[model samples]
Target: MREVAFIKQNKEKWLEFEQAIFGNLKKNPDDLASLYIHLVNDLSYAQTYYPKSKTVVYLNHLASQTYQKIYKTKREDTNKLIYFFKTEVPLLVYQYRRYVLYAFLIFGILTAIGVISARNDDTFVRLILGDSYVNMSLENIKDGNPVAVYKSGSNWGSFVGITFNNLRVGALSYFFGIFLGFGTFYILIINCIKIGTFQYLFYKENVFWESVRGIWIHGSMEIFAMVIEAAAGFALGASILFPNTFSRLNSFKIGFKNTFKIFLSTMPFTLMAGFLEGFITRYSIDMPHFLSVFIILSTLSAISYYYLIYPFKVHKKINLKNT
Candidate 1:
């Protein structure tokens, strides 16, 4: 069938679904579920036959909204917390996956610029990292403990302080998106450049391996969570910039709800990173090389899987159930 014909046939049903979704009309859970299943079938048909048609897009959007409505109606009976992490956030992440990619690409570019700038200009590291930090790191390198910075405070104190600081940074990275995402970009620029510059300093001192072993034991999850936070911010910003079929206010509301879930998901990983930095990173200097590598890889893999791989898995599972 032609796309126009397909849309014409389904248009009335889609409108009624939208009215139930967006209007003041309240729907019963079972009725909503029935409608949702019907909408999903239409969406599947449109995707297969109409492919790139706006009808498919419209049907898909309606199906998603209907699914949410069904979930909301059933929320009273479900374990909300488990349902949140297990299903809601992952769906939101998959839906806005592009923002994550954009955040990482921007971070990569800024980091590269930092590395290139530091490589060409001897003073660039000091300018970015500050003279005091450079001198302290140089002294640490001379003393054969390139990451001794993590050893300064008591473990408990360090954990609390580091965790609080990381939380604050993540919050800023996300809330700053209100400025249409430039504020979030600014946050990423500051941190990513510092990362590049800091890593370059160790490389310049010929202690790259030492720094990696020491820093990355916790830095892996810590850094990855920060990037995810930035992605959340970008998603928030994009809502304002491209409201699409939504009013700017409604778009921002939906964007904030979904993106905030993504931001909230990073909290556990951030805390874990702080714990490693406080207790484990201090031992990285003398720890077995294999052990350090394992910790680094494990933390990185766990966080990466949750944000990247697990979302896809959850999305697939949900889609299968809908089918």
Candidate 2:
């Protein structure tokens, strides 16, 4: 329908809602909630069909007010955590998948910069990955054991330390979203550049395939989860930066809840990555080529399906249920 016709259709109900809130047309909390849900359904339709219409803005404002009223008197769902993972997080991922895509793009571009810079300037590798790591890799390469660094530590020790560090990085990536998301961007810059330079260092030594054989044993999940965490950070920052019709504080609460759920969702992947790094990666060179590829592909596929494919499926299911 045209925007004008759409508004005309809902304008009377809109005025009724305004009066309900402003003129104190008393209603039970559950009734207010029922109204809120129906309003959101309308708002969702407006967003999909008449996104640029002022009707969407008006509906969003009205829905948010209803939300606030309902929430103030709402009872907590005891299965909230389970519900969050099964429904809420998937919906949020579908909603903010663009942020995730942006994270991947940022990572790719910065990594490409690192690779190009390292290829052009010998010092670029040292600058990005640091002299100590670059020198160590070079020494290991000269020793014909380019990825020996993966074997330097004990499995359990590496597992604990690596997992701990990855969690810290993940938390920082998500928390930094508070700084208008530059925090996550900066984190991505550092890591992606380092990855590019480090990979190029192997490439320079002509151990590119050999390096890939080892690094990807765990790097697939490790890297993918980090990128996802960065996306969560961006989503968090975006909530604060663009509150839409909601109050800034309310938007932040929504953003914080959403980002935290997304961030928490990555924990299993991060721990699995650490496990692969600790127990599995050390043997990457000795493992059969097929086995290495299997581990990498399986991890990559699992994360890819969950993040990329599963959300769309969940969205369709939700849509079907709502319909």
Candidate 3:
């Protein structure tokens, strides 16, 4: 094909590849493989048919820059991973923290409302929780057990099912962010409401503490994973809303890429939450109160440390090195 015709025929693909390589450069500046491939292609095409053209000059410049970048591949990889942990993850944590604060605040305010309404009208719990769940819990409470629900499912079956279900929910929450952020917010709102109402139902039975100890053992990880998923959603949405220096399409592409990483990070947490809910929660009633409290606090601390504190520390270290 003639040079112009070749350029015309493959222009779209070239542009797409250019954008992809450019985006990766911002995140992984020393990704030599991509840089090399892109540079070689552009250089070969330009040198072959556009020897005296301005495009040839541009291609040479880009190729030289890519070669320099390739030399720092090791440094770049390390910096990128550090940057992701520190800068990227922490920002996500901050967003998640905001969402959590909002979720809890809304939950607390609604619980107060539920309590007030329940006091004024005995049937309020029924309206919120439905009569069946309330009745079953009441019976369990009377029998000196406030959290019999955890024991209802078969152990092995519950573990597999709950784990699969929670992972699916987390994945969906992340995936739905493709619609921007509304889909993620919707997931957070629904779960917050369910948790609040569920807590209120137990509060009605005067077993709120018991319920919290039993439920939050697993709920901490599950809910936190959900929040991370929401952050992923926000990431996806932000790409569309604020591309910053990048084009909107480029932004969306990057956002989805980061969100996918975040989703992958939450898998182990989902499994842990499922294990706690399916197996550990049932035994909480049988275990000593102090032991249960310790387990809950320790898990919370670990989650907070890894997702919150660790990222910040990593970020600071990276920033210092970069500076």
Candidate 2 — which residues are off by over 4 angstroms? 1-37, 40-82
Q: What tens-digit string does per-residue lDDT give for candidate 3 at 1-323?
A: 57677667756654544554454425354455565566567667778887887567545434433433443444444576555554555544443344435444544554466556666776666776788988898898888778888898888888999899898878777787777777776666556655666777778778899988898899888877777776666667767887754589876875676567667777778899999888899888888999889988888887777776775575455335433
Q: Point out the higher-scoring one by TM-score: 2 or 3.
A: 2
What would the per-residue lDDT of candidate 2 be over residues 1-323, giving only the tens digit for each residue? 87778777877777767666645588788778677677778888899998887678678656645654564456466376666566566767877899999999999999999999999997888777788988898898888878899898899999999999999999998999999999999899888988999899999899998899899888999999999999999999998999864578878886887679889999999999999999999898888999999999999999988898888887787456545
lDDT (Cα, tens digit) per residue for candidate 1, span 214-316: 9999999999999999999999999899886668998898789879999999899899999999999999999999999999989888888888998899878
Kindly report which residue pairs in candidate 2 clash with one another: none
Ranking by TM-score: 1, 2, 3
Pitting candidate 1 against candidate 3, the one with the higher lDDT is 1
Winner by TM-score: 1
Q: What is the TM-score (0 to 1) of candidate 2?
A: 0.84
Model 3: residues with Cα > 4 Å off, grouped in runs: 1-124
Cα lDDT listed for each candidate: 0.89, 0.84, 0.68
In model 3, the worst 10-residue window by lDDT is 63-72
How many steric clashes does model 2 contain?
A: 0
